[model samples]
Target: MKAAEIRSKTVDQLNDDLASLKKEQFNLRFQKATGQLEKTARVKQVRKDIARIKTIAAEKSAGKKA
Candidate 1:
């Protein structure tokens, strides 16, 4: 997902998205370990998306605090 798209989501939604991404990341790791991961690039993509959500979430929270 794009940063702009992530930024549009509310904090609660972002949290939910982050949780789901983490679950998917876990599953992907299992797949990789078993040598069944066809789309290995997805693991990297999900990791980046998780980071994007987290960064935007932090920015939003900091904005609120300020």
Candidate 2:
């Protein structure tokens, strides 16, 4: 997902996306461990997406506080 797309989401939406991404990350790790992972690159992509969501969420929270 693009940063601009992520930034457009509300905090609640971001949290939901974060949760699903984390779940996918876990499943990807499991697949890797079982030697069944087809797209190893997806793990990296999910990780980056998670980070992006987190950064955006933090910025939103900080903005609210300020």
Candidate 3:
């Protein structure tokens, strides 16, 4: 998802998305450990996406506080 798309979502929605992404990240790591991962690039992608969601979420929260 793009930053713009993430920004459009409410904080609750962002939190939900973050939770699901984290779960996926965990599953991806498990797959890698088991040597069953097909697309290794997915690990990197999920990491970046989690970071993106976090960055945007923080920005939103800070904006609200300020």
Candidate 4:
């Protein structure tokens, strides 16, 4: 998913998306360990997406605190 799309989501939606991405990341790791992962690039993409979501979430929280 694009950062713009992710940023448009509400915090609750972002949390849900983050959770699902984490789950997918876990499964991808196992697949990689077993040499079954066809789309290795997906792992990198997911990691970046997770980071983006966390960053956005932190920004949102900080905005609220301010």
Candidate 5:
């Protein structure tokens, strides 16, 4: 998801997305451990997405405090 889209979401939604992404990241790690992952690059992409979502959430929270 794009930063703009993430920014539009409520905090609850972002938390949900973050949870789902973390679960996916865990599964990807397991797949990698078993040597079953098709594309290793997907792990990196998912990590970046998680970071982006967190960054947007933090920005929104900080804006609210100002």
Candidate 6:
């Protein structure tokens, strides 16, 4: 998801999204370890996406506080 899209979500939604992504990341790691993952690069992409979502969520919260 884009930062703009992420920023548009409510804090609660962002938290939910973050939780889901983290779970997916964990599953991906397990897949990688078991040699079941076909696309290893997806792990990196998911990590970056998770970071982006978190950064945007933080920025939105900070903006609201100011």
Return the lDDT, model 3, position 21.
Answer: 95
TM-score of candidate 3 relative to the true fold: 0.96
* Residue 48 error, candidate 5, Å: 0.4
Q: What are the runs in model 4 whose C-alpha is more than 4 Å off?
A: none
Q: What TM-score against the true fold does each predicted structure earn?
A: 0.98, 0.99, 0.96, 0.95, 0.93, 0.90
* lDDT, candidate 5, at 19: 98
Off by over 4 Å in 3: none
Best by TM-score: 2
Q: Model 2: per-residue lDDT, tens digit, 12-57?
A: 9999999999999999999999999999999999999999999999
TM-score of 5: 0.93
Model 6: lDDT equals 0.90
Candidate 2, pairs of clashing residues = none
Off by over 4 Å in 1: none
1-66 in candidate 3: lDDT tens per residue?
A: 888899899999999999999999999999999999999998999899899999999999999999
Question: How many pairs of residues collide in each model?
Answer: 0, 0, 0, 0, 0, 0
Better model by TM-score, 2 or 3? 2
lDDT of 4 by residue, 1-66 (tens): 888898798999999999999999999999999999999999999999999999999998899899
lDDT (C-alpha) at residue 4 in model 1: 88
The candidate maximizing lDDT is 2
TM-score of 2: 0.99
Worst 10 residues of 6 by lDDT: 1-10
Model 2, position 39, has a per-residue lDDT of 100
How close to the true structure is residue 45 of candidate 6, measured as C-alpha lDDT?
A: 87
Q: Is candidate 1 or candidate 6 better by lDDT?
A: 1
Clashing pairs in 4: none
